[model samples]
Target chain A: MVCRVILPRQFRAPELFPQVQREFGRLERIPNHVQFDFSQLQFARPSGVVFLSNLTRYLRRNGCRVTYCGLDPSRDPIAYMDDSLFFEQHCGRRLLDSSQPRPTTRPLMEIRHTEVHGWIGFQLIPWLSASSGVPETELAEFRTCMSELFNNIQDHTEYDVGSVFAQWYPQEHKLEIVVADFGSGIPRTVRTVEAIDSDANAILRSFDEGFSAKSRPTNRGAGLHYLRQNVLDNLGGNLRVHSGSGVVRFEKNGNSHQVKLCEGSGFCPGTMVELEIRTDRIEFDEVNDGSFEW
Target chain B: MVVVVKDLVSSCDTNYDGMVVHKHVLSALHGTDSVVVDFSGIPNVTSSFVNCAFVALLQDFDFAQIRSRLHLQNVNRQIGNLVRDRMKKEAATVA
Candidate 1:
């Protein structure tokens, strides 16, 4: 039997998790062929692109005959994916037809880190700062936050490969970033080091300031905390993490921060982090009074 | 002796890159009583960068020695905070 899945019109993070879980559940029940219809997709963020890539890969690996259909070249729903090289790396082909003249410029970036040092420096920081109009110094905090996310995938997950898709919308004055990994999810990896009651708790524990799953000199466990601080506390951005059978969302609406946790009906094979930063809200001049002499 | 952070690493983002700079600092620390870590011209830094570059020093040296010997110069307030926070966390972890 063939299973058909219709893609969402606007696919971005925080909103994308429940839909992904629903679609994933539908795809799981099917025994054979699967068709992912993308005609309805109008706007897609980096998280959406990564999710599509990961989902496609997951389905294909599970012995299903997967076909992508209903993609409209005119609407350009796949622009972010195309710009990020999601189609090229994941599907071994380009998304845009050769005959179609490609748009000269787009704000999306796709980072696939094969090794550590070369990718993170000049190429990433300028793009993020320039697009967001945030000062390089303030953006540095975000750079550190993202770097830690990349490090987590490399150091903790069995799969060394990680993908990051980021896009800045000048009109909206917002930057959205998605970092993903196809490996053991957070719960499974954390369980390796300490006992965890559930995937949700494992995710919650990860946010605790100095919690790292690894032991001794190597495990600093400051990545997630820094991420939370920079995104939610510093930039007033929204953060969502989906892994295994749980999803956690941290959103800052004005002065109050709202956090929500839910158990997914379906399992995400790995971990995905989606963050949205409102560029206008970032404080470049903000400084901490606390100092470290040691 | 001064080890300009920008000269050591192109960008201060990841821990691995920080570790590379940390190695350089460790080597620099051996010969001199004090070493200056200048963040001049460096655009940005992360907690992981701070943790790997400076906070990890706690593994080998005492906090007081590191405090006395290592001088952070030209760093912005954010980088300063990140370094300090990572140091405190690392101190708590080690203790």
Candidate 2:
């Protein structure tokens, strides 16, 4: 039973039911169970859990046998396991495990570029998202997470050799992004600017607010910090970072956890960040129109 | 033709004169035997910037027109991907 994925304004606003209705129509003609991948959608302002609860009710009435593919839900199932009730209330019964078959590994996009500076990481994300059918809205946040790291590389390095290698494993159901540059790395960038003895501890603390080596018109070094809160804290994922030979890892699964400075390396000219994201919350959809918004 | 070296390419904010800079660079390549586009002053650029600027110029001026004459100096890795992605997307859409 092949599924027809509808995107953007193919359905109208103020309600997601129209999207369901169209899919049901297609199903009636084809006799195949329908799946709606809302992953590419960008709602003007989501009205919280009530709207989702109502959607569940409407789909049940139609015996649509529906399944949701894309929606960020903005909360992590692993991190927020305590409040399974909370997720059910807002996201309906089709939470984490029930969404789709989780992959042991997935086909990953590998981008090799030596000229884009820190962008290998950032650029890899869109291509991966687009190829994997990760919705643009969720993809935007994923890119933001990588941007925090990419921006750091761009600001801190003058490396002539740059490389970004990433893999999206299906069984792991995660996208692992690794970016490396042969520049000053994190220690030198911090030592020269902040006069602080550089180490993994310093880099860890630097993810906090007011911790930038450079000052811009509107930045507070909050990219890493924000990522910790949203993707790690809110999304139930893992962040592993190694810079200047120091390594620190953060993982959240219904609680915050970390493993620090367990290893060091001589690969100190630049930074390497590996971010693993589960595909359950990923919505692969076209970015052409408002089916999703950035 | 020597395109007046204005500024190197940057991010994809149309409000930031990046679009204008790109247009000027493209316009200078009217019928010149060879055109050199300098990016000495530019630091970084986004995929969208290359799409709206350089890739758009390529779209406007077919490959045969600018292939040999056009040269981008100080090409960064990020901008290269941006151009490549935009061109691929444009080509896919056109075909």
In terms of lDDT, the best-performing candidate is 1
TM-score for all models, in order of appearance: 0.82, 0.42
In candidate 2, stretches whose alpha carbon ends up further than 4 angstroms from where it belongs are: A1-127, A215-219, A257-259, A263-267, A282-294, B1-95
lDDT of 2: 0.48
Using Cα atoms, each model's DockQ against the true complex is 0.43, 0.03
Instruction: Score residue A258 of candidate 2 by CA lDDT.
Output: 61
What fraction of the real A-B contacts shows up in model 1? 0.43
lDDT of 1 by residue, B1-95 (tens): 98987777777866666899899898888888989888887756766677778877887887778878988887776677778777866676677
The list of candidate 1 runs beyond 4 A from truth reads A1-3, A8-32, A39-45, A61-64, A75-110, A115-120, A215-217, A253-257, A286-294, B27-30, B92-95
Q: What is the TM-score of chain A in candidate 2?
A: 0.50
Best by DockQ: 1
Model 1 chain A lowest lDDT segment of ten = A99-108
**lDDT tens readout by residue for model 1, A1-294:** 777878778875445556656755634454477787878888876777777677666667788787878755556666655655655665566677552212322223334565433455565566666776676766766666676777676655665566666666688877777777777788877887789887888887888876887733566677787778778877768888888888888887677767788786456658888878887877766653323354
lDDT of 1: 0.70
